[model samples]
Target: MKFRKATSENVQAIVEMIADDPLGSKRENYTIPLPKTYYDAFERIDADPNQELIVVENDIGQVIAVFQMTFIPYLTYQGGIRAQIEGVRVHKDHRGLGIGKTIFHWAIQRAKERNAHVLQLTTDKKRPDAIRFYESLGFNASHEGMKMHF
Candidate 1:
């Protein structure tokens, strides 16, 4: 598998991956449903210097996974940067193949290259397996994450 920055052309595959997630059923509760237009905006935002959206491709050159990361600059941490990771999903067929680990390692490298002091992500508490997987990747369950819906 190979990982690279996502382009607008990869939108369809990305949307399919996202929609395949269990959480996708709650899209109506979120602000935006996955759509081609959202992908277009992602492409534009990711093109900026502070953002990155990545996709993992299989040997056949098909996009099989997708994630987005953003870098936030701050003066509070002695001029350090933080990377927030979101939208991580692997193709249903590709799970249990270590593709997720590969993509995550790629994201870590990318974050280091961007001089980010820390990397963070959140998973729903209900996903025990996913929480364990993230812990195996050296992430800590240190803080409570809250979201408000309007």
Candidate 2:
């Protein structure tokens, strides 16, 4: 498998993988012609220097996973960069193939390459398996994460 920045052509596949999950199915509109919002969000991410929207492809060049990494410059860490990963999803057909670990290793190395002081992510409380997987990767639940949705 190969990791690369996601292109416009890969948006649909990415969204499909994302929506394959129960949580995502509740939120994402995965349709024949996906909503304009998805493309617009992709364009914004593509343009941002601090954001990397990525796709993982199989040997045959089929998209098998998707994730986004955001590097935030912070005053709290003495002007350090904090790498935040979100929206990670592996295609339903490709689960349990170690692709998740592979992509995470890639993301971690990428974060280090960018001089990030810490790499962080949040998994929904509902996904115990995801939490365990992240723990296996050496992440800790260091802080309580809270969010408000409008």
**Predicted candidate 2 versus true structure: per-residue lDDT over 37-101, tens digit per residue:** 99999999999999999999999999999999999998987899999999999998999999999
Off by over 4 Å in 2: none
What's the true lDDT of residue 74 in model 1? 90
Candidate 1 C-alpha error for residue 86, in Å: 1.0
Clashing pairs in 1: none
Candidate 2 to truth, TM: 0.98
- lDDT, model 1: 0.83
Candidate 1 ranges with C-alpha deviation above 4 Å: 28-36
Worst 10 residues of 2 by lDDT: 73-82
The Cα local distance difference test for each model comes to 0.83, 0.95
Residue-pair clashes per candidate = 0, 0
- The best candidate by lDDT is 2
